[model samples]
Target: INFNDIKEWKAALCLLRSSPNLVELEMLARPEEDNLVRPGVSFWAESNQFDCPFDQLRVVRIVDVVGIRPELDFVKFLLANSPSLEKLTVKPVSNDGGLDLLKELVRYRRASIQAEVIYVDP
Candidate 1:
């Protein structure tokens, strides 16, 4: 899913909300042109009205993350909602802000005591 696209991102969230039995999930962000303007609204935070938890989801992998607020919010949402999640891996588009990204990710509350957030270089 392209996190930069509001419609696509919303659709992805809707899919997640409906897929309570999802086990492993992966999101790959295709690098977009730098000239494009980023969305100003924090959709994840605003649309966080999930009624069901991701009970069966265990693993998740997100690639090409750029440390955007929306991306971070989405990660935080998943961590706080997916009680069965064992591991969530995030691979940045580059090493820039990687440490800060990792720090921010760890600050979010986790629903699963065993859930581990891994940050990797691209």
Candidate 2:
């Protein structure tokens, strides 16, 4: 799955639920400054309740990762749900907050103990 303009969490949740058998998922995004969607809207709001588990998900590659809350939340969601996930490769759009992103993602409690995280600098 390649999410290009995924700005809202509602949309993100819907897309995630639509694909229950994804082996690999990918997204196209830029840096935080050039956010694809408008700022200030929380993607992971409390009112939105979803329990979609990725039963067949394995690899997740998000291009031009910006480490925004929504982006990171999306990653955290996958890590917490995808039991079969093997690897997560993220290529940042810039050096700013790249390390921070890694730190945050690496510490997330992943359902798959074998899940490996890779951060690529551009």
Candidate 3:
């Protein structure tokens, strides 16, 4: 699922819950036009934990990742649950990070034996 703002982002999660056979999921994770509101929020996760096991999910590409709590948590969930995941590509909002985000993402426990987390800049 892809979202441009908070409302869309929230709706994306619901869509995610309903998509049991989802093979891939992507989130813009920020306002496409750079709206000042960032750093993420906790309320977006206020829902029942369906823990929808992504049996077919193989790839996840999140653009404009801000490394916020919610984003990080969602990434962790994917890593832990998506047994078929083969790759996770994160393109941050900028070419920053100093490799910190990459390192953190790599530390997550992926259910897939061949899962790889890649960070890119453009």
TM for every model, in the order presented, reads 0.89, 0.78, 0.74
Q: Return the top candidate by lDDT.
A: 1
- Over the stretch 43-88, how does candidate 1's per-residue lDDT look in tens digits? 7776657575899999999998988777888898888888999999
In model 1, the Cα lDDT at residue 101 comes to 95
lDDT of each: 0.84, 0.75, 0.73
Tens digits of per-residue lDDT for model 3, 5-117? 55665676667778888998876775345443355544334432555677889999988886656666678877877889999999888767727788888998888999999
Q: Which whole-number lDDT from 0 to 100 does residue 46 have in model 3?
A: 42
Q: Can you list the residue pairs that collide in candidate 2? A: none
lDDT of 1 at 75: 92
Q: What C-alpha lDDT does candidate 3 achieve relative to the native structure?
A: 0.73
TM-score of 1: 0.89
Model 2 Cα displacement at 53 (Å)? 0.3
Q: State in Å the error of residue 56, model 3.
A: 0.7
The superposed Cα distance between candidate 3 and the true structure at residue 24, in angstroms, equals 2.0
| Clashes per candidate (backbone, < 3 Å) | 0, 0, 0
Angstrom error of the Cα, residue 59, model 2: value is 0.4
